[model samples]
Target: MSSVQPYVPNKDFIYRAADALADSHLQQALAKAGRGFVDKRSAAVTRVPNFEAMRDRARAVRQKALQDLDIYLLHFEKKVTEAGGQVHWAETPAQMREIVLQLCARHSATRVTKGKSMVGEEVYLNEALEKAGITPFETDLGEYILQLAKEPPSHIVAPALHKTRAQIQDLFLHHHALGERDLSAVEAIVDEARQVIRDRFLRADIGITGANLLIAETGTVAIATNEGNGDLTATLPRAHIVTTTIDRVVPTWEDASAILRVLARSATGQQTTTYTSFFTGARGDTDKDGPEAFHVVLLDNRRSQLLGSEYQEMLHCIRCGACMNHCPVYQAVGGHTYDSVYPGPMGAVLTPLLRHRDGDYQLPNASTFCGRCESVCPVKIPLPDLMRKLRNREQQEARFKGAGYWITKVFCALAASPRLYRALTSIGTKLAAALGARRGRFSKLPLLGGWTAHRDFPAPQGGSFQSQWRRNGKAQPPVGACPAGD
Candidate 1:
């Protein structure tokens, strides 16, 4: 395997993954996963008559919560304290890491067992712990695989989905100290993970997890998982910590229930997760297995700036992975191409927002604006619209607002003129088709060398749709009128 690091915003990694993803193997895997997820989601939607209405209601709840975030966050903190838990606020990733490390120090933690929390990933918690000499063990299977591989998450929901069973088997055989045995099946592989990690749960000094939703009214945190890993990570140690973005807060337990109704179904086609546990505080009266101390770290990390902005709707994401599941681009390239902890449609929107790009540019233009993501989002987030806003952000940045930007603006202005647009389109299509006709595809592109390096370019069609429409007496019809026959 290549020693390539997680595809951060580094220009080189982005281009490399874009090139590597062109291989047929990656394409086949992405296509299979994408189509399967969409079909399953469609079937699930059909099963619920009020699915659309439920999404609308979920949207309303999240909107109301975000609109009044300050009020609800304070309410959440008060109740959590009342329930025998302490709340900590982090304004940035550095502060978040510092607080967690101090908490670990307070417990004299030598080893920390962790559940899969993307917020923790966002803060690079494992690295922080390692720097402080605390060994952080990933309890979630997917996370465990990634930790063994020393790789960041490729996809948000399915962290190890990109790795096939064979790869996993190979990883286990090479990494696990157990003597040789059959590793042909998924069950065997899971057994290996469990055998290795089960002891870590009991031996660790602290347990940490990510919260799905934080209920302000009850001061309760919800953890949803298919595996029992989250439970182990939350209960097996003396101290338990939940790291989450401030956006996770819901006004009340009733509102959280409403969101949960859509979260699992949209995520994995389950009406409810196999394990949806609500923890109010640490181990209490008659609670023998839970931790003695509970702490919730609410990370701001640029989110407060996003509150009143056009991209605020993105805060509603429940990490369901629906948008990525249905995205055509993500299907073709997998999550690696996006070059971040977040990937796919939601990543396309959130990565640029968090990373702070400088230019008349953001990377989400990589899409065709199909709007399928928006249609399927359980919380009704307008993903494409937000993606466009990110693009505008690039334009607003001074670094990218120069000559290249003016040229692009001029081209868009020209393209708006129908006569010139059709002429340019006709000429470009003719040239492209002619260039590719000999071999059925263009092996290289003039301006998009990175795009063409690994895959052949699809030739343009002979005629534009608008041209065909105009030739058939469909030109200049009334704004809302039907075709000539109608």
Candidate 2:
């Protein structure tokens, strides 16, 4: 899908999604997808006894590589140049766009076909190409659907998850020249897309793709996918342009193998992706069919600023989409609510850093802080901690930080004082008990209507354990104070 850069406030997105979620169909879809993803990933991970150990190794590999990123990047540049390819460093999206535009101009190309690459989405390449009088085509089925509908992707892996099959049939009937043919089944849809994208692949002048991993030691781009669209995009056109973030570098192919083992299991419950293609350079003179010109654009849009920081772990993400698959917020709201190229738990952290750092402040507050994302992450990225850090950064420094800041600060400070905490707890419990509904749930709350907009909040219990202990004349609880399971 192309880039969508309009700002979205967090409150508005939450409310909108909360409303959409009330629909039984959407809720059913979310529940079905969530259980399927969780179960499949669990089964896939169970098959591998040493997956946790591999995660540890993968984490260390990325950490060490990030320490000397510049060295590895220069090494990559040299190797790529030696192999009859070019490497361009783009410090910003605009610079990347300019470079690709210039490449198109040099080639005198009007049509460009793309593999589904998030980096290409990051730079809004299709829109930029269109503005430059070039027609850009998305070859991935989900991406093509979003392209035809003129909508941002709703999920990272399944961009068209929000669209029903009937909606797709209508879309195809309206767009495809097949002119109202029977398109009711999934296989039929697949066949239709394959037929349409074949022509675009053959006639396109330049192809663009994203790399899953960039091997710094060999200057190879590793494109992983269930479909071989990436390979088609990289090799079929006259010129192939790879758009990748600077942080994708790991040190070696060995490291790539380790990460790959975890990526597919986490992403789609497959043992390995159907196609894992590694390209060292342009198709050589001895090679038969590959792009004549190859360009690898290393994009550093705010990634350089992320080095030696708390958020550096985000760089280790392989874009596996595991976090999104397991995320509660993403399962409900999908990608569009975040209103960024990157979406879900990872997007909550990365989007604000990548685009609209000041005014576009809604990206960070889009989570429930459930640690499932971290648990399912193949590289063991501390997503929840990173999210809290982003929220803290916004509260402390971002110009668009919201009100109620002092109130939150006051509560935190009160919690630090035992006497004040006890006093507040007593008062809060009594008030909650007095004002709560018969079922002990509050339908609405002052200054917290957002929380009660869609569902009721359970009221606090009438007494704290500390207060009960005090009343019972016991400073210490019994040995079996722990719950039954404990």
Candidate 3:
């Protein structure tokens, strides 16, 4: 038997998070981009009367599809073969990369045009192509920006959401041969990128894209985009290759529609993206113009294992990125802080499970269990519950230990005993109140440098809730009433 190597997380998450916090450019970019998504989504949902019902239907479709994943995949394969296209299953990233390379090599592909695909990012497909001496051109505007800057995407839907206009101007000036053209306006930047990529689109032999949903009923791949880059990438090249995960499949076009109804609304606050293209197979004999060859590379990458597990619901994710857009942690530190291809709340749970590596354990702990991710998810994935499951598994596997664990243990033990808990709380509260009576808050405190270093800790004013309740002789509301606790 071959030995499997353990996964090791990127060690730069903490340092990068701190740097992002201090970076004025990144902060400004994030601030400008954050509220736009939130507001647009809010307006979109308000415009739809049955938005919640649509979400429920989307969730149900995903659940049903995952329940019979193998059956649907086989059906999809049969349909694809019947339609004169090919289906390739890859159990790992390495296998997927190799498969794509072989296909490109067979076609003598030199230059490849690419649409935005997170799965490609997962397998580092661009690097693989470059290593094999093939050049890959990013067609998506945001992707092109990141490609020129040599940075991984900060957000899934909006890859360059972390970059400001000033930064983009500098990148374009440094990379493009613009003869003193004024690049200050956003329109100029768009035009510059469009002109550059249009040539690549026409010249490329192969085009690679990710599917929003794979329809098993018709062997069709559906993609949604605002810029129509995916359409150009699919139709312009001699061969079109789809690199996507198994979880993206749906049983039928109806299922795809159910999900699509909420996808754009959740993703960018639009009722639908400007371009929603569907391609089934290679160009038909009567077709005016399309790819000569069609290939689908479906990657498992541990998602198959995820189907039957407690984390199965995560497969329902439509990649709309509503969770991340609303996530406080993602908004504060940005996507690069997570040190994974997927970032924010979804990444926190999904990355560790998919990677199952050493440092991934830290990801689950990254959340405050705020549950905003679950609240905003278009497919209703219980992100907080899944993260908690990972944390519990870590505890059971003894993946974490030390003063923190012991402190939690001691607190739990004390919490179970009312007398001891009261005694400790009373003493601590009195001490803190007395020390900060004049200042009203503590700027520094021993054994709490983590909290005090960034912000002041407000001094305890009143006694414990139980103590206050006893003195007032008032009945307290149930815990559920106070969902947002201090």
Best candidate, TM-score-wise? 3
**lDDT tens digits, residue span 1-486, model 3:** 222233233486676778888989999999898689999999999998999999999999998998899899999999988888999999999999999999999999999999999999999999999999999999999999888877889889999999999888888887887678889999999999999888999999999999999999999999999998899999999999999999999999999999999999999999999999999999999999999999999999999888788888988889999999999889998888887889988999989888877677777887888888899899999999999899878877774486767888899999999999998898888888888899999999889999999999999897766677777637654667557754
Give the worst 10-residue stretch by lDDT in candidate 1.
1-10
Error of 1 at 226 (Å): 0.5
Order by TM-score, highest first: 3, 2, 1
Comparing 2 and 3 by lDDT, which wins?
3
Estimate TM-scores for all models: 0.86, 0.91, 0.93
Whole-model lDDT values for every prediction: 0.84, 0.82, 0.90
378-399 in candidate 2: lDDT tens per residue? 8888988988887787788855
lDDT by residue (tens digit), candidate 1, 1-486: 434245343365356456747666556556546567677777887899999899988999999899889999999899889878899999988999999999999999999999999999988999999999999999899999888878788777789877777667877887887887999987899888898999998799999999999998988999999999899889889999999989999998889988999998888888888999999887889876788899999998788888998889999998999988888777767777776778878888887788664321345776779998898899989999988877676676655366667988989988889789889888877888787777878888887796898897888655666666767646455565666676
Q: Which of candidates 2 and 3 reaches a greater TM-score?
A: 3
TM-score of 3: 0.93
